[model samples]
Target: MGWLHSLFSPLKKLWFRMHSTTQNKGRGIYILYEDVKSCPYEDVHVLWSILVESNSASLPSKK
Candidate 1:
């Protein structure tokens, strides 16, 4: 138990740092449920990008 705690302590700190950085940059992660025909070049990016739905139907309504 002690060894496990020692090993994971550093990992936990690293994960927190990464999560905080992502939040600070105002970037979010998402999973695409289906394939899309096309998307804007400026919106869709490989990493740390803001997800924009080309179709309004695919997006959830804000209450």
Candidate 2:
């Protein structure tokens, strides 16, 4: 597996680093590998919308 893996590890790491930040960036998203038991997509979406609305409300209005 060493030779087969060596050629791909760097590429995998580079891709992961490049595109993985969105999965978790402290805004309000998370990846639960384990069983979450709660907070399904709908719930998360509602929460996300709420946060966005609150944030937008806090911002000054534009003409």
Number of the top candidate by TM-score?
1
Q: Write the per-residue lDDT of candidate 1 for residues 1-63, one digit (tens) a residue.
A: 999999999999999999899886554222341222244453345322333535455778899
RMSD of 1: 9.8
Q: How well is each residue in 6-59 modelled by candidate 2, as lDDT tens digits?
A: 999999999998777765564333433222336576776676677768988999
C-alpha local distance difference test of each model: 0.58, 0.68
| Backbone clashes counted, model 1 | 0
Off by over 4 Å in 1: 27-63
- Candidate 2 off by > 4 Å: 1-40
**lDDT of prediction 2:** 0.68
The TM-score values for the models, in the order shown, are 0.39, 0.35
Worst 10 residues of 1 by lDDT: 28-37
